[model samples]
Target chain A: MTTEKINNISVTTLANVYFDGKCISYGITYADGSKKSVGVILPASLTFSTGAPEIMECVGGACDYKLPGSDNWVRSEAGEKFSIPGNAKFDIRVAQGFAAYHYICHFG
Target chain B: MTTEKINNISVTTLANVYFDGKCISYGITYADGSKKSVGVILPASLTFSTGAPEIMECVGGACDYKLPGSDNWVRSEAGEKFSIPGNAKFDIRVAQGFAAYHYICHFG
Candidate 1:
């Protein structure tokens, strides 16, 4: 699989990375294509399908995830990768200057 | 028309509201279905069709909009709405700790 950069970010082989405003989730990808998740600060948990075209999750504490399709955001915590299909419908969440994360999805 | 409240917000007859981290755009809904937009703090501009269901936009800065999908956030400034269909694809942008906005979409 190959990765492409849209806004100075590298993404390929979609995976969910978790964080908690402190530590990040251990990196892992299943060969069977399932969902991977972890917890972070603010007692937040993230979950997503390791399946092609990923879907990630996050918890809200005054910040959240931001996807590619909306005007507002879903609340999120510090550490977690929210993955979704490139052409899938989704949103992004940020806490404004206190936290932010990046994501990438692949479709074939 | 009537309004519905979810997560402590009232949404009805979907409309686009603009803000600039200072003054919000004049509330208006054209009789004709079209996009309504304005600018805010970061020299940002938001444009979206004021049509049913609703899709808003926001420019990026240290902060941005946060939609209902994804784990990470796209970049955004203050005062703008990034709207999308109830089941459409999109992303949100926030700057963390500095700002955040709310959104609601009705699909009937």
Candidate 2:
């Protein structure tokens, strides 16, 4: 398929909420203002194809990440830098499990 | 919400696919076998509430993670370890942007 790299970065602020009666929250948002909020649930393994390149930040715990089409599974800690190819498809296999929060923004 | 710490760690493997003509893939999976695959599209920023405790591994780029109920915004590197409170809710704001992949597993 024909592909072109898109690099348009923008900034977005987040609001913090609680999880239990104690307090906690997690969610995802798209450039179009749509969002997906996730609660404390053990998630199954998942993967996806990239439509745009994204920068993810680790907040609470840690997670393992992998680039599709390669055996290189990169381990991300509480603070790390990583990149996903635009319009590319990849799979992630949670080897350790994660409680980390992320913010996914796009660059046009 | 009523909450309890759930640490049921299990192993899950991921398959790599392509993004462009090159081959890429990305997706998420729940313990019940439900999966959400993300393609090359800039995602909206999101957050969630924790139903279970999880460990996440970072594979590719860099991301910013924040814990719920706190002002602490932790920056995760390529290889680090962190933890999230069970049943807690948190939000992720992509500071730099990411192309990294992640694996999320659970421990019961």
Candidate 3:
């Protein structure tokens, strides 16, 4: 099942807007000091480079993601997840007319 | 001083996208059951109708807003706040080249 909500966290009041609003996210800090982000990607093909390894868990909608060194685009739907290594670059695309891709990013 | 973060809360994983992505927000629930939202408004002019009386507190960037029945647009910068009445409509605008307007929306 998809994780609908995250509990007992502190949220940064400001949003992190990237690619001129094509992607938006909020940083969240859990009670144990672990960090994550809840974000959405609008209809666009975008490349992202990671600082730390991340597990992207889909909560709503969907996207096709291509991991580093992969030629195939894998679909990640609600309740699905994909992992990306630190210092790696990957591509994600949400097609036009579809809903925005909503996800929770777990960082290492 | 600006309120940089909110503590002891839960966050909705999905986002509320408005005006075709010009405005985006994530819902937040406090430990005591109060609710708020962290959001950003990109460079655009938009109108919003309120269900509950709202306090829009700026945490970063800025916007010019016109309340219902007002002819003048007031500037709300970081650390500033403005209130809107329930059942009323208001207008907010961010300049084309300026940074996105980041805020915490508190509801009554």
How do these models rank on DockQ, best leading?
Answer: 3, 2, 1
Per-residue lDDT of candidate 1, residues A5-98 (tens digit): 1111111111112331322221222334432322122223333333356554333233454455555556633234345564454433343444
TM, chain A, every candidate: 0.31, 0.50, 0.99
Place model 1 in a CAPRI quality band: incorrect
Candidate 3, DockQ to 2 decimals? Answer: 0.95
lDDT of 3 by residue, A1-108 (tens): 999989999999889888889999999998888999999999999999999999999999999999999999999999999999999999999999999999999998
Q: Candidate 1, A103: how far from true, in Å? A: 13
lDDT of 2 by residue, B5-31 (tens): 111211111212222101122334445
Best by lDDT, which number? 3
How much does candidate 1 score in TM-score? 0.22
lDDT of 2 by residue, A4-100 (tens): 1111211111212221111112234434545432221112344655676655444223456678677877765444545777888765433433343
**Cα misplacement distance, residue B23 of candidate 3 (Å):** 0.5
Worst 10 residues of 3 chain B by lDDT: B30-39
lDDT (CA) for every model shown? Answer: 0.31, 0.37, 0.96
Using Cα atoms, each model's DockQ against the true complex is 0.01, 0.03, 0.95
Please identify model 3 stretches exceeding 4 Å from their true place: none
